[model samples]
Target: MTTIEAPSGRTTTPDVQHIDVLVVGAGISGIGAAYHLQHEQPGRSFLLLDALDERGGTWRTHRYPGARSDSDLFTFGYGFKPWRGPSIATADEILAYLDEVIEENDLAQYIRYRHRVTAASWSSEERRYTVEVTREDTGEHLRFTTDFLWMCQGYYDHDKPFQPNWQGMDEFRGQTIHPQQWPEDLDCTGKRVVVIGSGATAATLIPAIAESAKHVTMLQRSPTFFISRPKVAELAATLRALEIPDEWTHEIMRRASFAQGEELWRMSVETPDALREFLIESMRPLLPDGFDIDKHFNPTYRPWQQRLAAVPEGDLFTALREGKASVVTDTIERFTETGIRLTSGEELEADIVVTATGFDLSLFGNVAFTVDGEPVDFTQQVTYRGIMITGVPNMAYVFGYFRASWTLRADLVSQFVCRLLTKMDEQGTPVVVPQLRPEDADMPLLDWSDPENFNPGYVMRSQHRMFKRGDREPWTHHKEYTEERDILPTADLDDGLVYRR
Candidate 1:
């Protein structure tokens, strides 16, 4: 990396030093980008920065009691970095794996920790980005200009928690907390707990909290379709014994699993009555006799239309069956002094309340972006292959598919970024950006996910800001990494993404 002084009063680094590539967020996307860049372009210059002192974005940030990856380890693990742990890796294990990847690839040298990028502006005259970043430790600020930017920053923002305006939440005289900001020293053992919202986080939080909490009441506005399977360790073991490469094995298993789910999705959407009856029948035995499973278990949308909750080996169902846990499918009327009042005139008393509502999905912390000295609104921009933002030259953001393992999509995005950069270098292209035609608005790009603005208000917020193109083809989300493999690394980059030589 080279540093150069600029005439704009701020001491800047090489438009080239920070140039070849500037990867933000040290999570899966950042590590993946650095890993591929080092291998593909050995002599290229780059830097990776994260807000935290250590690496491993989400895996490091979230330390809830039983945090773990919902995706199978095979698919969740980096394609190049095969996960040797259980198929479903605990949060700790995932963090460790990220550490291993960083050390093994010697990516530490390229990473500048605690350097949180606040804003990035594209320079029209120089054809690069002027990034403003602050050091988290000393409050020291610095401005660095770069030729290219790679946003490996995941969709969610760290500081913001999704807390909806509850009728009497503020009036309650107790401590309330959101799972994303779970207190490290929190002690909920033997205390009555109420975890609100029904999503993946809720699923994970319920089981873990039930292990110690006196009584964990799960409150949901509506019941979500849930499926359970064995953890990744078992699956990984079976695949390893057969001498299958981790990525290949992972892709095959995940693809098959998703295909089955997709078929079910089709059924739920095509034959709503049959699917509803099937779901009711499956969950009939769990609820009290004469209880309406249709009211609670049935959703307004089709299965897999949003995201399906992954339960571990029917643990959640078993917990409910054994009477250790209970579910209340009702809206919160208000928060009482000691507990929450339901819309059904029922009071659920709790010593502690856990909001497992879900996450707020914002792209890059909702930072205002400028390309070529022109302000770019993400809502006004279209995503190139759902990775590169239009009008932003030489930059790529790694976002995941709702239907598949996150790492699979992220790794693919990382690989494609490296390839795109290599091609740019070979062709002597200094800048590249998506140049979608004005008439290309009719093409679909994303799947239908949480359209009702449900779960953890942040997702709804991000969805509103996101450019949703409903096409399920080359631009659509397939959720299977194998099917998408050829599409990214080998896709005609020049078709949608404009490359200037």
Candidate 2:
């Protein structure tokens, strides 16, 4: 085994492998990073390490019935590859599409599955990051040194879904389940199920299992904004009918989707009341006549305050109209033996309960990080364009957009990282870090994100654990895709970045 001497005069063993770049998480972001690295920087050696046993990060982990993409595939799919499927695709369909990308690009060889990264430490003397990994299959520990670290592990805790504890939960005899860890053996046939929460997971699950289950009821303390649209993209369909190239169709549809997304965001900002009315009235026709839309469908928060759940073809409303599913907007007093008791003096009887609350945010895959000999405190640092953090050297993470498709931002970040790498090669520099400028010493720091802009339950719950952001550009994590698209491509690399040999 190749041994390397540690900074403390201790010898580290077990064969240390070295690479030019180490991409963490073989999911969508990581895969995209690998593709860009291979295509743009062919001379750089890179490896992808994922904790899971396979690829397709979220798609693989979420196996609930009717699990699908909330965002349209045209924008969600990679820029280089074209999405030939419907706008909103199922999890299986997404996994298949990812598989094709891997096969076409031959990226499987560079990916190491089931290798969980435990910790990462940067060495200033060597100008590299040493990442410690644990092989899940054989329980073997390994180390890899790399000049650059790309974090694509995503932002949620996969193993532990946010399970809110209600009073008398233990006393309830029904089978309790969270969508994150759905049990394959459990059958919902002819069961009366009550799902808690009004987010995307609950929106997706209720319609999916409504037909099979005897009855499904969605219980929520408050309502969320929902947008229903057809699964097929009219422009994409028209282009394909004319025998236009797949790549051309993809680009056209992607831009159209972006434009539509921009309009929605504009409506939310400029005229929120009009946008809210449009959303509510759109669902009125699909729902049963005289349904309590205001009580169940209306949200107190303004449009775009939280993410708007997209229901393809109004499937959720269809389920409600067919009497297979229903929605109850009320607070839960406690869980009962049969089901739950609401604060309104009502009881909901059920044989099963699904908590579609949310998931805990896992910043940087919950990996402990150290710079030189000092432990890095992420909450104390400010973000640099939401990619690189202050005082963290040779590391960049991909945190996608909340309003727009995630891959749109992922693609931009990948391009920027590649550009940075090219500049480093030209300057013969091995280390680069984001540092504050002298004039910016007194800059005010704020929460990771503005609640008014985007405040989901999960994000609000974990904002304290995230890195701070400044009020100015290059120091903030702006969520607008149109603005970022214009700014990121030609961003000055040396603005806040300090490069060293």
Candidate 3:
């Protein structure tokens, strides 16, 4: 941190927090970034700031029943940490893993909870960024300066889930809930329940709630492919039984899992029918007789176009088999006094409605950024190596891979930044920005995600607000971890960026 001195004979006051690096968000990404910073660039003063009052990001905020990770834990776990749990880990398990990461690396001392960063503007003359932050508890604003900024904030609006307007929705007498904001005191036992949407949240909620609800109905406009994943990993168990070191076990598990996922994705992209049939066949035996996989489980989009929903130990299928839950593939035309009216002229009765509709993506946490007092529009800037935005000095944002566990990309990004920072120190350069070459002036900017083809609602909604991508090197991102592994961690930092001494 930088020092402050008052005028002669006046008491010194440290009004502004200054540091070599300022990491935003104390969640998975931010914690990993801080860890790598301390490991690779020792003696650098940095601070980790989070708007929430805790360390866990996604897990800490979402408190709904049956809320858990769709992605497996071996890949989701940080590179430095070894996960001892099964692949299908719960939210609390993931939170515990994050806590372990923080304690083992001694990162808790540098973190400030309830510190929300409002804005950041880069000053070319000062070669530093002026950041505006507010304490959530007191609403008091503060200023900070840093040579570099790292954003670990995930995408999505934390305030509310995406809820569409249906006529008479508010007039309904039944209770309504969003999975993100599940009430702690509420009871669902012996009550008719309706869960809107067929994504991961709905998939997780129906089975978990069906055990208590009088009957649960999953209402959806379309279908999402469902797959049953084993709660225990035989290979991980085998590795441990063989006395392999924890680090090797972690690597082996990650690689084995990656290969399987890659093969599945490749089959989706190349021969989607084979993969789709395999998935449907896998589900057929788990459901009751005459259950229609085509109407309820099969998605119109090809496999891997969007992530498939996973259920722990076939709990969802068991719920369907036990006749505790049913699925409706129709849109809501209006809300009735008792429940909802479907566009297909069907009526559903419910005592509670859970709108798992989806999330509204919020880019950069709605924080405004400027360079030299001029606002920097994300639409005009192209991403450099899918991390740094063009012409933005001393900043990198963590955006994980959509096809794999989020931490895979997060860990790689942290490692990449550490490498860049190390090289910058050796070169005596303090500021670096990705500069678009003049030859690429005619390159047309495209949405970072190909959501039309992908059809994931969250990315489709927020694509316009994000940075653009090009078709060429360092301007585009591939979903394959092996490609990212070969490029991101060891990419030459001096190749395309402008560096200042």
Off by over 4 Å in 3: 1-14
Q: What overall lDDT goes with each candidate model?
A: 0.74, 0.93, 0.87
Worst 10 residues of 3 by lDDT: 4-13
Model 1 poorest 10 in a row by lDDT = 447-456
Residue 80 accuracy (lDDT) in model 2 = 92
Q: How close is candidate 3 to the true structure, as a TM-score?
A: 0.95
Model 1's TM-score against the true structure: 0.87
Model 3: per-residue Cα lDDT over 121-200, one tens digit each: 99999999999887788666678999999988887777677887889998899999888888988789999999999889
Clashing pairs in 2: none
Please provide, for model 2 over 39-79, each residue's C-alpha lDDT reduced to its tens digit, 9 standing for 90 to 100: 99999999999999999999989999999999999999999
lDDT of 1 by residue, 1-501 (tens): 565555653455433235567888888888888888888878878898788888888888787878887776766777676667765668999988888998888889999999889889987567788888867886656677777888888878787766887888877776788988989999888988888987778788778878777888889998887766577545556778999986677666666656755576667568867866776576666555655567666777666566767776766776676666788899888998899999889999988888887777767756668776677776656666777776777777887866667877887887787778778888998888877654566664552243532233455556666754434333434344546766776788767667775
Which candidate leads in TM-score?
A: 2
How close is every model to the real structure, measured as TM-score? 0.87, 0.97, 0.95
CA displacement after TM-score superposition, residue 93 of candidate 3 (Å): 0.8
